[model samples]
Target: MARRALLTDRERELIEGGGDTDDELRYQAVSRVRRKIQEELTEDIDILRENHPDLYAELREVVCESN
Candidate 1:
């Protein structure tokens, strides 16, 4: 199954200059939206792992472990 795209209409509008014009304000908005997207992506990855245990196990093996 294809992954669902992130970013809501409001977020897209903000990114496309449909929101604040001030540099600082725009930066804050973009930063907030970016963080939200990252969180959603992490959640989606977790759900995929839950649905496919073998794939998840292989992925864990490939990922380097930290001390």
Candidate 2:
């Protein structure tokens, strides 16, 4: 799998371990990791939109239709 960018130490540890502890803390950590990933993906898509308008428009249409 491709390695993701900008992961914090806590995120790395959480992803690697299966140890069960506080359920609330685990949920929060998972939410934070998901948010970080979404932000990174949004940035990448913005770059693509700027660089390739036609492709971006096509992708936008497909995404919108799915939603």
Candidate 3:
């Protein structure tokens, strides 16, 4: 299933405003959302590692280069 892109309230307003917003603001807002998503994914991975070690091992095998 496709998920909606996460956006801050300010980002939502800027998008709804229809232009005139600064480019730097757009970049910062996008960066904020990207960081939030990364943090959430990392937390979920940690939980999976503790609760489902075998599955986490398989995931690590596919995703980790050094491990």
Give Cα-based local distance difference scores for all models: 0.67, 0.74, 0.74
Q: Comparing 1 and 3 by TM-score, which wins? A: 1
For candidate 3, what is the lDDT? 0.74
Model 1 Cα lDDT, one tens digit per residue, 7-55: 5555556667744456665677789878865886577669769898787
- TM-score attained by model 1: 0.45
For candidate 1, the per-residue lDDT at 60 reads 63
Model 3 TM-score is 0.45
Which lDDT tens digits does candidate 3 get at residues 1-67?
A: 6445466568776645556888777777777767876997678679989999997897678778665
What is the C-alpha lDDT profile of model 2 across 5-54, one tens digit per residue?
A: 55666676776666764666667778887886588768877987999988
TM-score of 2: 0.45
RMSD (Å) per prediction: 7.4, 5.7, 6.8
Off by over 4 Å in 3: 1-6, 15-17, 41-67
Check candidate 2 and list the clashing pairs.
none
Write down the TM-score of every candidate. 0.45, 0.45, 0.45
